[model samples]
Target: MDKIEFLTEKAAQIRRDLLKMIVNAGTGHTAGSLSNTDIMTVLFYEVMDIKVDDPDWDDRDRFILSKGHSVESYYTILADKGYFDKEELNTFCQYKSRLIGHPNNKVPGVEMNTGALGHGLAIAAGMAKAAKMSKKNYKVYTLMGDGELAEGSVWEAALAASHFKLDNLVGIIDRNNLQITDNTEKVMGLEPLAEKWKSFGWEIIEVDGHNYQELINAFTKSSEIKGRPTLILANTIKGKGVSFMENKAEWHHGLPSEEELAQALEELSSKGEVI
Candidate 1:
């Protein structure tokens, strides 16, 4: 595959992985994982400095899925990247399975176990601070759901990152507009969201979450942000790739039926071009 085609194919595979895992589990978070599919694909395949062959590469880039419901995508992408075996995904959400609904620190390549909202950014901040203390060059990147911003702790962490001048921390907000219940704006507005981050002393970038080029651009620019943390407001659909599920809140934790699964596979196999 060409470089661009390679990334696209891998992202499609992650989408398929998500669909298969969720439909098989009979219950899992599909929409949020699907929403950030391309973002994960780009991070694992291109953007991040990770060594799958060496899972504990000390200087590797650190990623925290603060929106832990989206662990489905993280597990799939990590497994696909060989951070761990693909077979482990088959045991997801099973009784005593390590692959729970949220990210667990026990899992390889998983930096922390997180399900509760508002926890990821603080953890990322701490890690970045640690790296700074050790004078390690690693960067910490974290993603939070737009709806997850309602948590007060997130702002607290945001304030600390700026106060500490932790430029190594880069945060991303998945602005999918919808959460499990309803639209984010209707539930709790994040209008002037960018400005809010700016006031907190963060350098902000807005981009289309589904665009691999945009993702790379945003991350590349992250290294240049100085004096504090950075945030990327990634505009995304709730369910990004599949035709039926896109922007549908029902799919937040909803499983795709057997037929719907088949349709989703077909749609993703089309690679966002056409049937």
Candidate 2:
């Protein structure tokens, strides 16, 4: 198989793991996880400088999952990256498990324990600044939820990153439009979101979050740009793939029923194409 085919299958595997794990765990942010599936896949598969051997390698780039509740996808990707046993995925939300519902640093590959709304950019800014001061080539990638960006800390962190000219930082917004309670437009309109980030000195890119090739291109384009942080506003459906869940706010934290789980599995296994 070609590299693209390989990556595509790997992405499907990640999503497959995500659905099964969420079904077994009985609780998780399924919609968010599904929405960011391709983004997480491309990052671990093709883009980042990371390895299972030493997740904390000083020269390696970093990934921070700011939307931490959507960790099933991220954890599956990490396991695929060889950070830990794929079997550990079964421990999610179970007693004495290293794989919690959120990304924890105790896990070999996670950079930070991040469930809070808007703090990742700040932490990423610090890492980027540190890399600059130390003259390192490492880059930092942070992913956030559009709903979460309503927090004031996001702006503060954005200001600080721009002030320091941390061009090595790449921030991605999973703009799924739906948060836990309501659509972002109803909760708080970040309509001018891209312009806002740009005003804060970030180079911005907008793309269909579910498209693997577009996501890869966006990530690649991010690496080539310099002198400013790159912020990608990835427009995505709240719950992707499964018909009943897509764009439904209730699925934000809903656990699929046994029947629904079976249904999702059947749908995903059908080799359906999504544009």
Candidate 3:
């Protein structure tokens, strides 16, 4: 298989793993996790400069999932990368398991505990600034949910990143539109989203979140940019791989029933073929 086909199959596998994790655990943020799988796959497998065996290496690139509820997807990628044993995934969300409902620093590849929506950008900005202070070349990437944009803290961090000229910081907003309660616009309008980020002094790039080429190009371009942080508005479907759940807000935190899981697995497996 070619590189693109490989990434696509990898993404499909990640989605399959995500469903299994959520089903086994009996709960998880489904829509967001599935929607963000493609982006996370590209980052972990192709973009980020990470060492699985040496996860805490000083110069390694940092990734913070601001939308921490989507961590099932993140955990799947980490395990696939050998950051931890794949068997560990079976213990996800079980009693006393390190893989809880959100990202925690205790996890090998997790940088911080996040699930409070808007705080990730701030934490990522701090890490970027620390890299600059220590003269490190590592970049800091953070992914936020579009609904999380309603929080005042995200904007505050955006302003700080620009003011400090942290070009090494990249903020990606998963513009899946759907949130836990409903569509983001209905919950809190964020239209003119690109313009809003631009106004905050961020360099904006919009792309189809599921497309490997677009995502890789956007992330590569972020590094070439100078003086300001880049905010990538990744337009995506909420429950991307499953037909029934796509764009439906009801799947935000819903668990798939046994039949639904079987159907979902079939759909994903069929699409794993090389293009």
Which candidate has the highest lDDT of all? 3
Error of 2 at 6 (Å): 2.5
lDDT of 3 by residue, 1-275 (tens): 78789999999999998899899989999989999999998998899998888999999999999999999999998888888899999999999999999997898999999999899999999999999999999999999999999999999999999999999999999999988889789989998999999999999999999999999999999999999999999999999999999999999998999999999999999979522
Q: Which ten residues in a row have the lowest lDDT in candidate 3?
A: 266-275
Model 2 segments more than 4 A misplaced: 272-275
Residue pairs whose backbone atoms clash in candidate 3: none
How far is 144's C-alpha from truth in model 2 (Å)?
0.3
Query: What TM-score against the true fold does each predicted structure earn?
Result: 0.97, 0.96, 0.98
What are the runs in model 1 whose C-alpha is more than 4 Å off?
272-275
Alpha-carbon deviation at 34 in model 3, angstroms: 0.4
* Candidate 1, poorest ten consecutive residues by summed lDDT: 266-275
lDDT of 2 by residue, 1-275 (tens): 66576666776667778888888888788989989987887788788887679777889999999888899899988887788898988888999998988989999989899998788888999999999999999989999998888899999999999888888999999999999999899899988888989899989999998787888899999888888889988999887878899999999989898899888877776643321
Model 2 RMSD, rounded to 1 decimal: 2.1
Every candidate's lDDT: 0.90, 0.86, 0.93
Using TM-score, give the best candidate's number.
3
